[model samples]
Each structure stands twice: as C-alpha cells, then as structure tokens.
Target: MASAESASLGRKVRTAARWSLVNTVVLRLGNFATGIVLARFALGPAEWGVYGVAQTVLMVLLSANELGVGLAVVRWEGDLRRFAPTVQTLSTLSSGLLYLVLFAAAPALADALGSPSASWVLRVMCVSVVLDGLAQVPNGVITREFAQIRRLVLDSVNFGISTGVTLGLAFAGWGAMSFAVGALAGNAASLLGAVIAAPGAFRFGWNRAEAGALLRFGLPLAGASLLALGVVNVDTLIVGATLGKVALGYYVLAFNMSGWPVRVVSEAARRVSFAGFSRLAESAGPALADGFSRALRVLVTGTVPMCVLLAGLAAPVVGLVYGHEWLPAARALPWLMALGLTRIGCELAYDCLVAIGARHALLAVQGLWLAALIPTLFGGARLDGIAGVSAGHALVAAGLVVPAFLLALRRGGIGVRVVARACAWPFLAGAAMAAVLVGLPRALGHSLLALAAASAGALAVYALGVLPTRHALLGVEPRHGRHARPRALLPGPSRPPVPPPRHSSESDPEPLLDGTGADGVRP
Candidate 1:
C-alpha cells in the first residue's frame, strides 16, 4: 500500500513538472518576443532602465507581500482549509501595508535607486503586489493540489492581457508607464482567475493560534526570500546609481536576455520542487539527496546549452533581434549568462535546503551573496562599466554563493560528491558547446540567417551531448516516502514544531476591511 502511494506521488510530481515546464516555456517565449517589439519600437534604453527600477521595486515588495503565511495551505496537513481565513487576513493586511509604504515613499525610493523619473511608474506597477497578496490563498490552494494546468491557464490569461495592454500602450507612446499598467492589468486578471479556481478563499478572518504559528513559520522564510531577491535586484540599483539610466537600461536588457535561458528550465522546476523536496525530506537522508541530485542534473543539463548559445552569440542576438542600437547590451550578456547558469544550480540547492528546514543556512548564504554582491558591483561599475558589473555578479555567484549553498546542502546529507556528480556532465557539455560557439563567428559571418543556422546547429550538438541523460530527465524523482511534517513549511534550524495551532481554529466572516464584504470587496 505504501509502495502504491509512493508511486502515485511520484507520478503526480512528474506530471506537474512537465506541465510547469510547458507553461514556463510558452510564457517566457511570449515575454521575450514582446520585449523585442517594445525595445525596437516604442522604447529605448532609458525607458527600459526606468521600467527596470519600478519592476525591481515591485518584485521586492512581492517577495514578502504575504509575509509568507499563505504557504500554510501547502505546508501543513489536517484540513488545510481551516487555515485559509487566517492566511487570507494576514496576506491582505500585509499587502495593503506594503502598498501604502510604496505609495508614500515612492519618490524617496525612486531617488534612492537613482531613477527619480521612476517614481510614478513605481507607484503604478506595485499595485500588482497587493493583488498578489489577495490571491495568495487561492494560489496556495492550487499549489498544494499540484494544479499546474489551472495555473497555466491563470498565467496565460495574465500574459495575454498584459501583452495586449502593454503593446497598445507602448504604441500609444506610454513608454515605461505601459509596462506598469500592463502588469497591473495582468495581476488583476490573475487574481480573478484564482478566485474562480478556489472560491471562498478570499475572506477576512483570523485564528489567534494559527496566526502565531504562521508568523513563527513564515517570518524567517520571508526574510530569506527577500534577501534572495536582493541578491538579484540590487544589481539594478547599483547600475542606475553609478552609470545612470541609459547604461542601466543596457544592463537590464542584457540581464533579462541572460535570464531567458535560465527561466526556461528553472522557473518550471521551482514551481514543484520545494513541495516535492519537502515530501522527500520526510523520508530523510538518501531519498532526499538522490531526488535533488536528479533534479539538479536535469535542470543543469537543460540550461547549459541555452546559456552557452546566448553568451556565445550575444553580439548577433542583440543586433539581430533588438537591432544594433541596442548592441551595447551584448558586452554584458556573456558574464550575465554565466551568472544565470550558476543561479539555476544555486536555486535548486535553495529549494532543497529550504525543504530540509535549514532557514539559517539559507539566510546566511543569501546574506553572504548580497554582501559580496554590493561591493563587487560597485567596484565593477567603477572599472569597466556594465560588463564589469556583469562579470562581478557572475564572479560572486560562482565563487561565493555556490560554495556556500553546497555547504548548506550538507545539512540535508547531500555532500559535495552529490553536487559535483550532478553538475559534472552538464559543465562538460557546456564547455564543449562554448568552445564551438567561440569559433563560429568567423565561419558563419554576422548575419541574421547565419546566426539562426548556427544557433540551430549548436542546439543540435547539445541535444546529442545530453542524450545519455534523456532517461533520467523524465523520471527524475524515484518512489520515495511521502511523510510530511507540519513545521517543515520551512522552519528555521533553531525553531521547534508548531504546537498544533493551539489545537485548531475558528472561522470568522469579518469584513475584509473597514467597509468591505466577506469576499474582500467594497460594495
């Protein structure tokens, strides 16, 4: 019976992973294509730089928007729905507070980030954070069920709406504001979809016991997640402050391009990995270690070739897709590609470490990354402009953060050997692909058609190189035990088990706000 249940869980995980990959691939491709249009048609580096600033602020806010409690729906067992009202109350209140903070401080924040012009855009784009918070309950419910198809539909709705709105506005000369508005529209659509998916999820209620348990569980993870985001977004802050907006725009473009390859595989894997790893962690030791190894191996194998191609062909890619006017971005693309590749592995390690309830380890690793990043980024900007910044970012990730995360994984019984063995093949294949790409420019010439053919050929090489791991890619996780503990909603190492939400909760139909309805709507 246990064997049958394990097999069933494994099958579900595999299915969810497949759907998530498809969803990510489609959305990223759409986003990529849309960016090319915007970059080439209605916007310039300066506009993108400003948009980058606002986008950065919005992301940081979103990181901690729910204060981490909505995850309770997935983190605990025993009628998870009982925790919904408290999670909803906390999520809504926290997001509202964050939005107010953003609104009141938008000007100062913009100036601090060195893009005073981004103040209005920052205010507009950040509306999504509030919506994201409101949607957290339904979102968590969906996540707990492995409902990736519904998620795909929700995100597709967001993408389509954002695309339509952004394009229309950009063509109408809205510039950076177009992204702000489009993103806001997309989030609104997504929140509606979430409500439809999980009816009655949005309500005002608070269980004192559940609230305390959630705060204990969520705060550290939120802090760590925020730091993780800082590790990524602070680069924009540094570039804008040092090189000014246009240069920041170029850097943002290059960095986004680098993320293309990384996002293709990493985002999909992450959607299910944390939950899946949490389940495996309950089984402990070997099962957890082995599952992570396979997950890392698959992600690294898939990511390597794309990273190599993008980094290798950065010049033509920028010139052909976004036009030569944006060619300056290519200088930073290679180093950023390197950064993106390293980040994928670290991200998988992040999920594994989090699953094993190593919050302090996650915190320390992220803090170290952020600390190392600020100094290096400033120094890099002082020396060689955006490329130097990219190089600095990549250097810190590979040298400092990656090793730190590896050490953290030791807590999960995954030693250096496990990580090295997982990564060795992908690194070798990537090096070969990189070697080939390095010499391709002279032979292929710098034309759109030539670059296309070369990219196709390079991908074919990667396909052959990684063919040996094809079997492992589909069946990445084995039939592991599925025992889960309530406290592992990602606990800090120093924390103890939550004492049963004080033996449970009571549902409340309090209004969402001063004059709002039970569904959080003001009518």
Candidate 2:
C-alpha cells in the first residue's frame, strides 16, 4: 500500500512538471520575444533603464507585501476553507498599506535611482500590488490543487494581454509608463480569472489562532524572500546609481536574456517539486529524500546544458536577436549565464527546505548569501562597471550560494556525494558542448541561421553524450525500498487509489485545495 501511494504521488509530480514546463516555455518565450521588440525598435537603453529601476523598486515592495503567504497556504495541512478568510483579510490589508507606503516613498526612490520620471511610474505601478494581493488566495488555491492546466491558461491570458498592451503603448511613445500600465491591466485580468476558476467567498474575517500559525510558518520564508530581493535587485540599483541609466539598461537586458534557462526550466520544476515534496514530507524518511534527489538530478540535467549553450553562443545570439546596438549586453551574458547555472541549484535547495518547513535554515542560508552578494556586487560595479557586476554576481553565486544550498540539502538527508554524482555527468556533457561551440568555424558562426544550427548540433551532442546515464537521468530506478516500480516516469494503472479524507463533513466543502476532485477546481 505504501509503495502504491508513492507511485501515485510520483505520477502526479511528473504530470504537474510537464504542464508547468509547457506554461514556462510559452510565457517566457512570449515575454522574451516582446522584450526584444521593445529594446530594439521601440525603446532605447535609457528608457529600459528607467523602467528597470521603477520595476525593481516595485518588486521589493511587492515581495514585502506578499510575506510568503502563498507558501503558507500550500504548506498548511489543516482545513483550508476554515483558514481562507483570515489569509484573504490579512493579504488585502497588508497590500493596501504597502501601496500607500510605496506611493509616499516614490519620489525619494526615484531620486535614488536618478530617474525623475520613475517617481510617477512607481506610483502608477503600485496599484497592481493590491490586485495581486486580492488574487493570492485563488492563486494559492490553484497551485495547491496542482491545477496546472488552468493556471497555464490564466498565465497565457495574462501574458498575451500584458504584452500586447505594453508593446502598443511603447510604439505610441509612452516609454516606461507602458510597462506600468500593462502590468496593472495584466494583474486585473489574472485576478478576474482566478476568481472565476476558484470561486469562493472572500470576506473580512480574522482568526487569531490561524493567523499566528500562518505567521510562524511564513515569517522566516519571508525573511529569505527579502534577502533574495536584495540579491537580485541590489546590483541593478548599484549599476543605475554608479554607471548611469544607459549602462544599467544594457545590464538589465543581459540579465534578462541570461536568466531564460533558470526562469523557464528551473522555475517550472520548482513549481511542481515544491508541492510534491511538501506532500512527500508528510510521509517523510526515504521517500522524501529520494524525491529530493530525483528532482535535483532533473533540474541539473536540464538547466546546466542550456546555461552552457547560452554562455557559449552569447555574442551571436545578442547580435542577431536584439541587434548590434545592444552588443554591450552580449559582453555581460556569459557571466550572467554562469550565475544562472549556480542559481538553479540554490533555488531548488531553497524550495526543498520550504517544503519540509525548515524556515530558519532557509533564512540562514539566504542571509549568508545576501551578506556575500552585497559587497561583491558593489565592489564589482565600482571596479569594472556592468561586466564586473555580472562577474561578481556569478562569483558569489558559485562560491557562496551553491555551497549553502548543498548544506541545506544535507539537513533534508540529501548527501553531498549524491548531489555531486547527479551533477557530474551533466557538467561533463555541457563542457563538451561548450568546447564544440567555441571551436565552431567563423564562417558558420557569423550568421543567425548558422548559429541556430550550431546550437542545435551542440544540444544533440550533449544528448548523445548523456545517453549512457539515461536510466539515472530519467529516474527509472526507485530510490527507496524495493516495491512497485513506476513504468516510464509516471505511475501505471496498478497504482493504488487514494483514501478519502478523514475530516470530510456535510457542512464542510470538499478539499478543493487538495486536488482530489474530478474537475480539480474548488466549488
């Protein structure tokens, strides 16, 4: 019975991972393509710089307002319906207050970033904060339920609307305001979709007990989030302050381009793995350990090669897609790509800790990472400008963040030796691919088509090189006890059915947040 349940959970994880991957590819690709159009044809570096500064400030505020409540919602094992009202009330009130604070502080932040126009942009974008807060309940509900397809549809709708509006306004010469306005529109649309998809009463109610429980679970995660905000945006802030807006613009562009692999692949895996790991942690022991190991293997295998490819092909890619005017971005890409590679491991480790409710440990790791990152980032910006910032960021990630992540994983029973073995083959494969890319003939490397072909060839070589480790790569072997083995990467028909919840009652609604219903939606 235990083996059957493990197999069932594994199937669900695989399915969720697949759908999340689809969503990430579609949403990120759209955003990436639209950004190219905005950077190359519609907006200049100075404009992107202004927008980037405003966006960074807004993100910091948003992270604070969120306070990691969505994670609390997922991690909670109690009755979610009983808990919903308190979550909603706290979220709405906090966001409203945060918005007021951001609005008041906009001018000062704008002065700090050296963009007078960013003051108004920051004020305008603060409206989405409240809307995002209101939507968190439903968003959390959807994710908790593993309703990936519905989530995907909503994300697609939001991305399409936001991109269209932003691009249209950019072409109309609205500049940075285009991003602010488009974000507001997108948030509104997404909120509406969430309400429709996960309909439930959201009224003013407060339960002190529930709120306390949530705070205990969420505060440490929120601290980690705050530190993360620093690690991600402090460099942008430093570059804008020291190097001027145009340089910051080039740096932001390179940062975005280099983050494609992490954002699309690692993040996708994280979305699924967090929930799966949370569920498995209830069972604990070898099941959770094995799940973590498999997830780590999958994340490294997929992301390392992509990061290598991006770093190796940075110059041609930037020149062809975004034009030569943005060539400065190319120079920063390799360092940023290296940073992304290390980040994949760090982020996965963070998620694993969160799933197991290891908040203090998570906080400690993030605090250490932030401590290392701030001085390194500022020092690099002062020394070598944008490229130096990128190099410093990569150095901190590889040196500090990666080691911290490995340590955190050890707390969850994932040994360093296990992680090293999983990562070894992918790194070797990626190194071979990087070598081939570097050795490509100049004639073939000069054109976009040739570059694309070369990249495909390199990927093919990586695939072939990793073929000997296919079973481990695919996680075909069960990591724990000898029992029912999963066919392929998913559960088969022989997998056992899950038992009904013990707490079900006539007055209580079904546990829609548990993803046990047929439609996978809350009524």
Candidate 3:
C-alpha cells in the first residue's frame, strides 16, 4: 500500500510539472504574439510607458492586497475548514480597503508620471486588484491543498481566452483598450475558474486571532514585495523618465522576453516549493536539507542553461519574436537574461526562507536587493540607455544576492556547502554551454539557423557533461534511462550521518520524513 501510494504521488508530480511547463510556454507564447502584433498597430512609446507604469501600480496594489495571507493560510494547514474562512474574510476586507486607497491615489500617480491618461488605465486595473484579492484566499487554498493542477488548467484556459479576445480587439484598432479588454476578460475567467476550483462554499467571517497570525506572516511579505517591485521596476520608471516612452516601450519588450523563462520556471517551482517546504519544516533536518538540495539542483539545472542560451541568442530571438523595430532591445536582452539568474537565485533563497519559517529574513533580503538596485540603476540609466539600466540590475543581483542565500542557509540550518555543491557542476556546465554557443555562432557569423543549431549542440554537450552527477544531484537519471521507477526525480533518503543529529537527548531518532507533493506525492 505504501509503495502504491508513493508511485501514485510520483505520477502526480510529473503530471503537474508537465502541465506547468506547457501552461507557462503557452501563456508566454500567447503574450509574445499578441504583444508583438499590438506593438505593430496601436500603442507607441509614450503610451506604452504610461501603460507600463499603470500595470506596475496595479501589480504593487495586488501584491499588497494579498500580503502574505496565502502563505499564512498554507502554513496553518492544520484545518482547511477554519483556515478557509479566515483567509476569505481577512483578504476580502483587505482587498476592498486597498482598492479604495489605490483608486484614490491613481490621479496623483498620473500626475507624477506626467500622463493624465494613465489614470483610466490605473482605474480599470483597479478592478483586477479587487478580483485578484478575492481570488487570493481561494487560490492559496487550492494550491496548498495540492489542487494546483486544477488551478493551472483553469488559468491556462483563461489566458487563452484573454489573449484571443485581446488580439482580436487589438487588430480591430481598439488601441490601449484592447489590452485592457483582454485583461478584464482574463480576470473574470480566472475568478470563475477559482470559484469552481476552490474546494468549499464561499464563506467569510472575521477571526481576530487568525487575522493577527496572518498579519504577522503576511505584512513582511507585503513589504518585501513592495521593495522587490521597486528593485525590479525602477529601471522602467527611470527609462520612461529619462529616455522617453519609446525607449521604455523597447525596454519592456526586451525585459518581458528575457524575463519570461525565469517567471515560468521560478513561479512553478515556488508554488510547489511553498507548499512542500512548509510541510517539511515541521520535522527532520536531513530530509529538509536533502529536499532543499534536490530542489536547488533541479531549478539551477533547468533554469541556468536556458538563461545562458537566451543571453547568447538574445538578438535573433528578440528579432524573431518582436520584429526588427525591436532590434535595439537585443542589446538589453543578454543583460536582462543575466538578471534572470539573479531573479531565480533570489526565488530559490526566498523559498528556502519560506520553508524554514523565516519570512522576515526573506523580507530583509528583498530590502537588500532594493538597496543594491537603486543607486546602480540611477547611475546606469544616466550613463547608458536601457542597456545600462540592465547592467545596473546585474550589479545589484551580484552584490546583494549572496547575502540572501547565506541568510536562508543559516536560518534553515542547512549548510551552505550543500547548496554550493549542487550549484557548482550545473553552473559550470551552463557556463561552458554558453561559451560554446557564443563562440560557435560568432564563428559562423551568427546566422539564425546556425545559432539554433549551435544552441541545440551546446545544450546536448552540457547535458552530457552533467550526466555522471545528474543522478546524485537531480535525484534521478534521465527519463529514458534504464533504472525505471516512479518518483525517480526525487532524492532517495539521505545517509544518516550526512544530516545533523535530530536531538541531543534521544539516543536514536527515526530518520527524518521525506517531504512529499512534488509531482503530486500526497504524503
């Protein structure tokens, strides 16, 4: 029975991973297509800049609305029935309040941006804020309940519908409203999907104790998010302020393309990690350490090479996706891709912090990122164009990211050596692959076809180089390998001595329990 359950869990993990990867690819592709086409038609530099600013405001508000309510609920996974009401009631009230404040502030923000037109965009997006907040508690519940696959499916469908609607309207010459229409459609679809996907009847009632716990867990997250948002988006703000809207539009194009892969991988990993890690934090030092190591291995392996390849192929990829008019963005692309590595690293560290119940540490790390980001961005934007802005981000990433990881590692009681060990070979392999891709394409005068061929070859070579260590690090052989078993991707039990002793008082403690739920392992 145990074996069967384990096998069932493994299947679920693989299915979820597959669905997540596919959904991310589809969503990114849809956005890329519609955005490119829209850029060709309706919006220009200034309008795009205004649009970017408005979206950032909306995102900040939305993030603030959730704060860390979802995380707190997931952590309080003791009783979903009680937790659900707490989440719903608190989030709804908070969302309503935030909407009022943000909507009221929209006009002043428009004035700040020197674009009164931004007010309407901000107002329209206010609806998303409210809807997003309402969705939060349910969405968190679904995800924590291991019903993520359902959430993924519903959101994917919503994205498809939204993208289709937006593009159709855009081509019909609806201008900025086209994108807004699509967003509205997507949000509505998402709300309905969340409602259906959620497990129980919608209920809301205040519980002061639960709300206090949630506020403790969530407030720092909100602060962290706000700071991180500033760290991430300040470049665009600077670009719009300094270089004008046209340049900001170009920068957004490159930024989105480069950052999309990171978003897909990191967000998927985070969803799984947040739930899985929170559960693991309850017991077993080695199990938690092993889990962290294995998760890092898979994330770095998958993310690092992709980032390097994107950096190498930035020019051609951007050209193909967004058109020649966006060619200037290619200069910004490699740096943007480099920024993804930092972004992913930050995510990994944050997940570790969340896993270890050190949310405050994560908040501090976010503040560190902003501290590094601000001055460099100011300097970079003044010195260079958007490209310089990207360089500044890379600098901030390098300067502040290490401390975040160190802090997470310390808090988790996991040795930094474990993380470093997992990262070494993958980083080397990715770097080597990147160098090969860059050299091969340049040696061949950088034909698009040649770049494509070289990229494939580089990835293959890198994979081969990592093959020996793959089993140890990735916790599984390749999918096609001879050692076939369910849950192959997960790490086996840690050797007893590798993990710290469970307690000084006990002579022998049973091994730490395995953290489950990746690929759908129930236990």
The lDDT leader among the candidates is 1
Lowest-sum lDDT 10-residue window in model 1: 508-517
lDDT of 2 by residue, 61-171 (tens): 656565565465565665778877777787788878989988898999888887777898889866877876677677777777777888787877777777778889999
Task: Estimate the lDDT of model 2.
Answer: 0.72
* Cα displacement (Å) at residue 22, model 2: 1.0
Predicted candidate 1, C-alpha RMSD = 6.9
Question: Residue 17's C-alpha lDDT in candidate 3?
Answer: 55
Residue-level error in angstroms, candidate 1, position 388: 0.8
TM-score of every model versus the real structure: 0.90, 0.90, 0.87
**What is the lDDT for 416 in model 3?**
77
What tens-digit string does per-residue lDDT give for candidate 3 at 266-312? 65666556555554565467766876777777777778888888888
User: What's the number of clashes in each of the models?
Assistant: 0, 0, 4
TM-score order of candidates, best first? Answer: 1, 2, 3
Q: Each model's C-alpha lDDT?
A: 0.77, 0.72, 0.65
lDDT of 3 at 191: 68
Please list the residue runs of candidate 2 whose C-alpha ends up more than 4 Å from where it truly belongs after superposition. Answer: 442-453, 478-523
Where does candidate 2 clash, by residue pair? Answer: none
